[model samples]
Target chain A: MNSEILNIPLNDYKTTVESLKNEGFEMMMDLTVVDWFRKKEPRFEIVVQFLSTSHNKRKTLKTFVNDEDLSISSITDIYPSANFYEREAFDMFGIIFENHPDLTRILMPDDWVGHPLRKNYGSGRIPVQFKNAPKVD
Target chain B: MKDYKVKKSKLSNFKNKLDFWATNSEEGGWNISSTDEGSQKMLENENEEQIKIQTGTEVLDDFVIDEETSDDERMIVNMGPQHPSTHGVLRLQAELEGEVVRRVKPIIGYLHTGMEKTGEELNYFQGPTNTTRMDYLSPLFNELVFSLTTEKLIGIEVPERAKTIRILMTELNRISSHLVALATGGMDIGALSMMIFGFRERELILNFFEKTTGLRMNHNFIRPGGVAADLPDGWQKDVQEILKVIPEKLQDYDDMLLDNPIWKGRLQNVGILTTEECFAYGITGPSLRASGYSWDLRKSQPYSGIEKFDFEIPVLNEGDVFARWRVKVLEIFESLKIVEQSMHNMPKGPYKIQDKKITPPPRKRLDESMEALIHHFKIYTEGFKVPEGDAYVAIESPRGELGCYIVSDGSSKPYRMHVRGPSFCNLQALPVIMTDSPIADAVAAIASLDPVIGDVDR
Candidate 1:
């Protein structure tokens, strides 16, 4: 019910987050990217949730990232915990987080080919071959 | 390149060392630079030896010392991806200078099945089944958060009985989860009897769960509208039995390990995480509380009528492995208290909401009424639709604050569904806790954190 969402432009993103940190939103609770693909322009939306323990308040921040330019400023400097969350967002959505300490894959294997969570990516499975079993054509 | 040995110092000097370690630990302890030929050659030689050992070609050397390496030399060691203490498939690449752990990087994802991606494929009604598997230990908490998010998006209030049932089951789940944490934590610290006692008590709660939910682990009992079914007959008797027995067992555990010197030595003052570090690292729940930050989602956020129940959030200023362990033990008593309160104050009513769009018609109603029959047929076939919006709901899971974020585009299936697993966030604090500690204490630190790999890699 505490739907206090702040939609900020790309330019003001870092400054807004820095101010939020200064304003006592000490914890960056969750960071994730929502890919819209053909449904909406600026194909990706970065959603972040911040919690201020002192005030018991939660704020949700939303920012858009275009598919052509998938890079965004990382908030890891403000919240060291954003390190893994940023890596996960990068791993799943292929959105580049500029200045992230280690922006490599966190959940997926390093050799994995594509970002699996992207809407454009197919959710296909590999066929299992059973040894010494008859195959049905 | 300089000598890295920390000298024995006074209390104030040790505090300074802790502060220095806190800042420098983030750089990661055991990094091998590509340009550093000596360390890189040592690494390659170690790998070659590993290959030889695997192929049964190398002789086992228990105490072979190389003259090339100095006394203060640091070497990289892999604790697991297989080691019993690393919990499950968690590979920790530690930088060790003798028995001391200089740095640790927890490499996970071996158990990753992409549950978040799987959640998108499932509709709102079937969402719990996917989320429930994320935190296997507290499966109900996962389901509860997912259902809470869905219910938030739909703007529907469940019945009082349903809310009470959710509280009752989740509190019981918290006890079972903490019991496993205690068991594993005790086992890691060499308190084998404590492990057995912990599991023995846990079996009683698990039996109650098995009787009610019909599954031991991933019970998708908590749904969007409400719970799957009503509590079975004689449920109160089972509840009473758990309440009567666990307190005595807890007393026995206290008698066994409370003042034991070995237990204190292994856990106390090891893996000290202060409140500032907890906030910066986004640590929550008992780990944060153990650091003296008195915040619990159950107390502060209060979901599913949880605030109606009376319970205290245990806090300790030490923030060491002992404090984390002690916080969890104290939390079990608090959860038991909540369970008892919910059982006594439970109101009789419908299990789920009576909305025709959400809850399906009863079996008896389906036989009598054509409208009810149509409703039942439609509900299961396509599931219910949610309004166009996004909502994030957080609840105090045993691990920490487990949150679910759902984005809906006016459809039965969520456009995007993401679970903020506490284990995933809590794993980031590993370097801070494990760095500069002894190898054995590293195990204790990890055990105290109590991260479920399923939850972390999900």
Candidate 2:
């Protein structure tokens, strides 16, 4: 199947990315951090998705990071496009990248407290209006 | 300050840093910059300690770049959290040398709804609701990709009729999205007449969407198993009307914008990028196509029976503002052609999966069959479960390749769902292409890029 998952070790994440780039994964399709808080041993999984336009295939490299140590090698060197994705990972999961060019939050505010995407973070919701049709009664 | 960072990498071979400084030009067309190596400068130097306080989300780092330089000929200008040209709340911080732009950093996330994280709380069936909102212009593509990924994981084929409906609706959506792109590009550049004409056709297509799905935007019609409902009666007539009207309108646009001297002057050779730069920066869809690469997901990676349709993928080699404008305009005709074919080959049968576990029983069945009543109740209340696995599906949206990655854990709710929004990835090409252009062309570049900030931020 074109859609397949490959487990990438936390330590070997950079090498895996480097090898994939050599094998013609032209672009990093999407890079996201999945927080499987209660289900998995490592609290975070840095999911890196790559697309090889030459071969017409998709490969997903997932590296696990525990809650205590949230860090991974940045793939910006392999793909300059990883600039924003890596920063987004840091913003949401607190997964510090080793060598990102600019590891600033891409989607969240500068002063926003805590990684809101973390499983433990509050709902990030506020019940303001239109709850069960306005209370005309 | 950025010109001096030397933390070495294999791909770090470039001259003159792409840094940011706020511009105070009363007219605010472009900017100017230089350094005499000593005296007071109007462009205030960012206080190192103050950048630490104002740094949004990056960890503060120490002195790396030489603060004072021999050349003080650069000025940074912020594009928009509110500027009309920028489609939405996209802020481009550019470092300029007089009229030429040296660097552009796109600061986004003003419209972030955090929908990806929230998708985990919703089950497989409820996924479309969250995803459809991601790419607000091409909402159906968002729903279609999410549904396709989940369907791949669950290992089920949607009924042929549903697949056909999806193709038809999304193709129509593609036309409307591109219309918005054309309109905004026209309004951003100096083609004011193109703006009014573009919205007129878009309004007609939106009426079709309202008929098929209840809502005008964010229609969660495409479900995991199939579409939420079958095509409404007389949808064929509406589809035919759209197909007939768009081609004629496109011909009119060709007259107004295509060969017009002013349009050519503003767009031609502006914001040029080679095919390698397009590939390197992960730009897809029209932007990549404009660079003369025919790497469309619909053609290369066929989905929802797009392979069966007969259409030509437009390719433009110029890779500039005018080339992208031409590329999108041509693709609209191609999309209209797909809608025509879909209407001709419309399948007749159930519009959703027949499996009771995945799809609810029909309304009439609820009256006669007890099992149907129970199944309908359970399906709506709890939703269907997807087997433990992940699927990544990419399809061509108007802006670029819109992809979605869904991970399920054999539970009702998803483990993770991520949308690789085309605008988000395509916007990366901005800094790469904008580093050496005039400021006016940079606006044209941003407009030609057609970044819907909702999609970019989401």
Q: Looking at model 1 chain B, which ten-residue stretch has the lowest summed lDDT?
A: B53-62
lDDT tens digits by residue: candidate 2, B320-345: 88899999999998998899999999
TM-score of 2: 0.85
- Minimum summed lDDT over a 10-residue window in model 2 chain B is located at B54-63
Q: What is the C-alpha lDDT of each candidate?
A: 0.84, 0.80
For candidate 1, write residues B240-280 as lDDT tens digits: 99999999999998888889998887778888887887888
Instruction: Give the TM-score of candidate 1 (chain A).
Output: 0.90
Candidate 1, residue B302: the lDDT equals 92
Model 2: colliding residue pairs? A110-B56, B33-B72, B33-B73, B33-B74, B34-B71, B34-B72, B34-B73, B34-B74, B35-B71, B35-B72
Deviation in angstroms for B205 in model 2? Answer: 1.0
Chain A TM-scores in order: 0.90, 0.86
